[model samples]
Target chain A: MDHSGISVLFEGTNFERLLGGLWVTVKIAAVALIVGLILGIILGVLRTFKNRPLRVLLRLYLEFFRIVPTVVLLFLFYYILPRQLNFNLPGDQLATLVFALWVAAEMSDIVRGALISVPQHQRESGKAIGLNRYQLYRYVLIPQAISLEIPATINLATRVIKTTSLLMLISVMDVINIGQQIIEANNHTHPTGVFWVYGLIFLFYFLIDYPLSWWAKRLEKKRLERANG
Target chain B: MKKKSFTRIIAAVSVFAALLLVLTGCGNAKKSSSQSNNPSSVQQIKKNGTIRIAVFGDLPPYGWVNKDGKRVGYDVTLAHQVAKDLGVKVKFVQVNANNRVDALNSNKVDLVLANFTVTPERKQVIDFAKPYMKVSVGVVSPKNKAITKASQLKGKNLIVTKGTTAENYFTSKQPNVNLLKFDSKTQQFNALKNGRGVALADDNSYLYAWSKDNPSYTVGIKSIGPKSYISPAVKKGNKSLLNWTNKEINKLTKQRFFVKDYNTQLKPYFGKEVKPSDIVLPVK
Candidate 1:
C-alpha cells in the first residue's frame, strides 16, 4: 500500500478543515439559492408582461448577465462592490448579492419560457372567468408553470452549488481552497496528494449534486408518465 | 429520447459552467481599492486590539496553514511581531497573488504581510513600511528537462502566479517566453508538476522550499533579474499604521529580530542552502 501522499488528509486536522470548507461552500450556495429563488421568481413573473420598455429593460438585464461570464461577476462584486459601496460586506453576503441578481435574471428567462408555454387557450380560459392579470398568475398561470419550471429550477440548484467553487479565487476558503492549502502544506512528502485530495473534492461535489439531479430526473419521468396516461 | 435527455443533461450542466467565451474586463482590485483613505484604520485597530494582516495561505515557508489547521510560516512570524508591537491580537486573512493588493487597499486588512514584493507600480497604490526580506525571481523545472538559463525559456511556456514579480519580469523582459499565469503558488507549482509548462517562475526563496518538497524538481535557474525586497504594505498613505509599522520594523531590525525569526521559522526549510543574511534585509 503506497499510502505516501494520502496521509495529507488523515494527518492533523486537515480533513476537518476540508469539511469546514464544504460548509462554507454550502453557506454561500444556500444564500445564493434562497435569495435567487425569491428574486428570480419575482423577476421571472415581471418578464412575462407585455410592456415594451419593461420588456426591453428585462431583455437587456438578461442579455448582460448571460453574456458576461459568472466568474467575472464574482470578481466584480468581491473586489469592486466594497469600494463602490464604501462599506464591507462579508464575502458570502457580497457573493450572495451578485449571485442572487444573476440567478434572478436567469430565473426570469426560465419563468418567461414556462409561462408562455402554458397554452393560449389556458390564458383565454382564465380571461373568460374574469381573472385579472394578477389573479390569472395567482390562480392559473403559476400553478401550471410550476410543473414546467420544476426540473430546470432543480437544475439551477445544482448550478448554484457548483458555482460556489469560484469563491475559492476570492479568498472564500471553499473546499477547493482548503484542499489547495492542504496540498501545499504537505507538498514536500505528499507530492501526489493532489489526486487523492481533488478526488475527494470530486466526490464531495458529486455527493451533494447527484441527489438533486436524480430528483430532477424523477420529476421529468413522472411528468412524462402523466403526459402519456 | 435518450439522446435528447443526454444532450439536455449536458446543456443543463453547462448552464452554470457558463457560456463564457473570452472574458471582458470585470474587476481590477488595484484600480478601485485606493478610493478609501482609511487613516483611522490604526485607531480602529488599536481600539479593537486586533490587527488584521493578509497573507498567502498556500505558500509555505512564507505563509501557510500547517496540518494543525494553524497558520504558520515566515510571514506569520512577522505577523506575530507586528501584532505584538501594536499590543493587539492578530487576525490572519488569507489572500493570494491575484488579490493581495486589493486586500490591503480595500481595508480588509490593516496591513499585508503576504511576502509582498515591493514594485514600482505597486508603490503607486500602496504604502510599504520597511523591507525585511530580500528576494529575486527564480525558475524551477522538472529534473528531466531543466531550464537552467533564461534563453532556454525562449519559446517554452513558463508558469507564474499572477501579479508576482516573476510574471512582471518575464512578460516585460522575456516577452518571447509564453507565460501561463495562475492565481496562486499552489496552482503554478501544480501546473509545473502537471507539465502545463516547461518550468515555474517564482521568488527563488519559495521555489527553493517547494523544490525541496517535490524531489523530482529542481530550482534550476537559481536567480533572475535584480534583487528585490519584501515588506509589509498598508493602504495608500495610511500614515498612522504605516508610520507605526516603520518604527516597528526599525526596532526589529536593530534587535535583529528577523535573523532570529529566520533561525526558527525558515532555517529548517532552507537548511544549509540559505543563510539569514541571504534573505533578511535588516529593515534599516
Candidate 2:
C-alpha cells in the first residue's frame, strides 16, 4: 500500500536493472530450453528402441537427474567440474548447462510417453502400406507424437523459466538477485520496499509464464476436441 | 460467453491486485506510524517492555546458533547487556549481513548488533552507536597459493561473502580480480576449501580464526583495506536510542566488556594468535 516503496522501482536505474536481470533470466531459460529440446528428442527416440540395455541406460540417466536437486547439480558443475577438469567455467554458463540437462531429462520422459501413447496399430498400418521403418516414423508416428508432446513441452518451458531463479544462488545476477540487491540498497529508504520489489518480481515471472500456460491449455483443448470429434 | 469469461478473469485479477495493495498498505502503515510518531525516543522501547535486537544467526564468534539452539555470540552477549542496561527484556531477532540495516530501518528490530561494520554508504540510511569492535578485511588461501599483496590477486579467483566489506573492497579496489560472492561465511569458506577460488577475502578475525583450525590454509594477507569498526545500528532519526546505545557502548568499553567476551567466546577459536586487544575497540 505504501506507494513510496513501490516508487523505488521506477527511480533512476532500478527498474532498468531489474529488466536487465529479467533479460538474463529469459536468455538462460531460452538457451536451456532449446538445448533441452534437441537432446530430449534424441534421447527420447533412443529410449523407445527395443534393446534392453540401451533403454535401461537411458532410464538411469533420466532418473539420476530427476533424483538430484538442481542446486546441488549447479554446484557440482560450477565448482566441482572446474576443479576436476582444471578449467574455469563461468557460473551463468554452468547454470545454463545444468538447467539444460535437467530439462532434457524431463523432456525425454515427455517425449517417450508421447511416442508410446501413439497406438501400435498406426505403426503397423504404415508397415502394411509398405512403408519402411524410417518413413513410417516420419509420415505417421512422429506427426501424431508431436501433437501429444507440444503441450507438455510448453509446460516444461514455463518450468525452465521459473527454475532460472535458482541461478541467483550461484551469483548469476539474474532477476531475483538484482531484485535482492535493489531491496538491500533501498530497503532502508523505503522500509516497505521488500513487499513492492518482490511483488514486481512475482509479476515479471507471472507475465512470462501465464501466456505459455494459456497456450498449453488452448493446445490441450484443441487436441481434446479433435480426439472427441 | 467467451467475452464474459474474459471480463470475469480481468475482474478477478484486479480484485487480487487491490487486495495485495491493501494488505501491504496496512502493514506499512502500522510500521511507519509507530516509528514516525515516536521517532528515536527510547520511551517507545520502554513502554513496549522489550528491546528487540538483531544479531547474526550464522558467522561464529560474532553471532551464531549453538548446538543447544540458543543464539549466542559476542554481539548477542553485548545486546543482552544493552537490554539489561535499558531495563527491558531482550528479544533477539536473527539477521544476516545483507538484511541487518533493513531490519533496523523497517523497525523490525530496535537495534542491529550483528557485527555490523560502519560504512559511508550505510551511514546514510542508519545511525551507528559507538563502535565495540575493530575489524580489517584480509585474504585467506591455501599455503601453496598464498596472496600477500593486492597485485597478487590479479586475474585470480577471489571468494567473498556477499554484502561484506571484503566484497565491497574487491569490487572497487581490486576490480581486476575475479570475485565470487557466496551468501554466507560457511559457503565462502566451503568454496575456498573446495578449490573453487584461489583466495578468500573476509574479515581478518574470521579468516585468521578459521585458518588456525584448517592447517592447509593460512591468513596470507593480514589486512587488505583500512580497518573498519563494528557498531550497533538504529534507524537514522532514532536519536534517543542511538544516544543511549553510544553511552552504553562507552560504559561497556570502560568496563572492558568485549575483552571478556573475546576471552570466553573468541579466544577458543582465534587462540593467542590474535589478541583480545587486536579485535576490541578502544574506549576513547
TM-scores for all candidates? 0.80, 0.49
Q: What's the residue-level lDDT of A46 in candidate 1? A: 65
Worst 10 residues of 2 chain A by lDDT: A81-90
lDDT of 1 by residue, B153-230 (tens): 998899999988899999898989999999987788778878999999998888777676677888888789989989
Docking class of 1: acceptable
For residues A147-191, write the lDDT of model 2, one tens digit per residue: 999999999999889988888555476888767666654533465
Model 2 lDDT tens row, B146-196: 787889889989999988889998898878999999999778888998999
- What is the TM-score (0 to 1) of candidate 1? 0.80
Chain B TM, per prediction: 0.66, 0.73
lDDT computed for candidate 2: 0.79
How accurate locally is residue B277 in candidate 1, as Cα lDDT from 0 to 100?
84
DockQ value for model 1: 0.35
